[model samples]
Target chain A: MKLDSAGLQILSRHECVALLGSVPIGRIVFTDRALPAVQPVNFVLDAERLVIRTAVGSKLAAAAQDAIVAFEADEFDPGTRTGWSVTVVGSARAVREPEEIEYLAGLPLHAWAPGSRDHYIVVGTEHVTGRRLSSVDVG
Target chain B: MKLDSAGLQILSRHECVALLGSVPIGRIVFTDRALPAVQPVNFVLDAERLVIRTAVGSKLAAAAQDAIVAFEADEFDPGTRTGWSVTVVGSARAVREPEEIEYLAGLPLHAWAPGSRDHYIVVGTEHVTGRRLSSVDVG
Candidate 1:
């Protein structure tokens, strides 16, 4: 409901999660020694949990259990400088249940990073927000 | 040239910067309070400096002086599942110099966030790295 000066529409939580399903790739932001780090990963939404596959012992997998993380995805048309971006901040937990891991493996989650991507991490969408940039700014 | 098992090419510093130039939008990953936050912004790479515009009191603008940040941009085709992503990790500084602000204003840095976007911050690209997910894996 917050529209900035340019009339960029502040998307609702429902809208944010819906948009999350539209894109396959997004950046996952995490902290490394208190400094923010970002990496692009392909993800899938299983109901409300945002699932991603990372390599074993990878920086992402090694993230502290219940670590706070941020996920962002957007589809923009550079030609018109218009698009929608959604950000979800939540707690990340490793999927350790054998049954759950097997289920996630079949969820069509593709890890673009090459290697043994045997780790599954899920970020519960607690705070979802987004903005829509229109081609024509609302003056 | 560290190639991953999937044969994804590890991009060089020079190659990373070159790829960054090809995009007009990127995500500025910052820390809000004690947790990580990821927000998308329009930016322009000035040499090794990544410049972005934000509102005066926004979290991004109020980030700690010399705060470490990460900027990421990428393009992936769904059909081919191929794309490249570049990440620059460095310190962010507010662009306060009148002359500098004026010069940056003239650049094609579009601010999608509605507002005056008067505050400018520059991230010095201290460490630039990238990865290329090729449809053809070398493995």
Candidate 2:
């Protein structure tokens, strides 16, 4: 296991993507009124791209268009103090093509929030990084 | 159960603070190299302030100094389809004063990562907002 300067294990890109696929929810960080804002979102990983469905007039939809955003997903066990976190920094853009929307609509991406979530914001996996904390092996 | 325009329940300021105390982990969004980045860290809520401990030369400590960042903490039950998320947008300043650092070091804020985490970053509760999604009560 490779460890970073902080003593946390470094995860490869493949491991990060796989861990992302196993999670159902994540937090998307975007600029709101020129300040950083984070909102919990349910997203689907499609071929290294993050597909998020939201309302057309929502704040996220407006801020994420042709913007750089950060998406993070992780699972932690506080009891044993073990977990892994994966972060992706990339450009986000809304899907405007008809055929693309139709294809995304069938990708099993369901919105947990109430209301019509027709806007599909896709975040590219341009930069990916992950870290893990594991219990020290004891004989 | 007051619902917002998006049909999600709006959590009061008091509720948001209390929920933040219930959890020991959260995601902090800050700028890294002029782009947004999200890192999960263990934090403690001191009254209305959020305290985080990190390494002195780590990226978080460097970027969080006197910067406006976003902190989010939430808990969700996937089986019940219910969750609540609270976000705090405020300025994060490193505790440079020796007296303040000593006081903060006495708090229960502990780092989960294995490292010499001596730098303490305190985020004030400038703008706090929260939303919740609950299952409809049939009874």
Candidate 3:
């Protein structure tokens, strides 16, 4: 990994996906009513794609079907003011196949929101970008 | 202060603004080359608006001026599988006035990313919605 003068390291696609898998929660951003809306969801990855479980009637499920979306996850230390943030922008496709839904249900992913979370939204890993802040603001 | 049967509480605008003030880090989601992009920034609240200090040449500074954007912040507890998230969708107005810029620079807000952070992006609180999970997952 090459670190910039400011100690911000740019992460590759592989590294970004690996970090995504370790985190269970991330924010999914989509256009709702022509405005950007963000919601946090617990996700499990099928390779580099993000699989989110949500209620069929929820706004997230409604907006994610075959629409362009962005998923973001970050970890920061408030004490040190340093952390890594990864963002993935892709198409949110709805999983309609019964077999795939069953397979995803078997995964450890659980919806934190209280509701009948039966809808699955998949976002492909097409555009990925990430940056990690160093211990200090390096110049 | 409305609490649902599922233990999901609707936070009041005042409560939401208070929670935003308590956190120092959040994500700013904006359009980058017609695609949604998210970046983590340390923010300070100016009343109900989000103030982010960023580099002049950064994508955030470039895309934020007079643009529709979303700012999100949340806190979650993994052990309990519960958390609260607040998202704000509004227009980002660049702080261009020399006096206003100087005033904002004096505020405690500091840029975590390394660079000459000489720009300020402010997002108003016109659209604010937040949901908090109760102690138990009430169904």
For each candidate, give its TM-score against the true structure.
0.92, 0.96, 0.94
lDDT tens readout by residue for model 1, B1-139: 6785445789998899899988878888887887787778878888678988888887778763578888898988877778998888888898888999999888877675556787889998878888888753211
Enumerate residue pairs that collide in model 2: none
Error of 3 at A42 (Å): 0.7
List the candidate numbers ranked by TM-score, top first: 2, 3, 1
Candidate 1 Cα errors over 4 Å, as ranges = A1-6, A135-139, B4-7, B136-139
lDDT of 1 at A74: 92
lDDT of model 2, residue A73: 96
lDDT leaderboard ranking: 2, 3, 1
- Leading candidate by TM-score: 2
Which 10 successive residues of model 3 chain B have the least lDDT summed? B130-139
Q: What is the lDDT of residue A66 in candidate 2?
A: 97
Clashes in model 3: which pairs? none
What interface RMSD does every candidate have?
3.5, 4.8, 2.9
Q: Candidate 3's error at A37, in angstroms?
A: 0.7
Scored by TM against the true chain B, the candidates give 0.90, 0.95, 0.91
Residue-wise lDDT of candidate 2 within A1-139, one digit each (tens)?
A: 9999989999999999999999878999999999999998889999899999888899999999999999999999888778999999999999999999999998877787887788999999879999998953211
- Model 1 DockQ reads 0.54
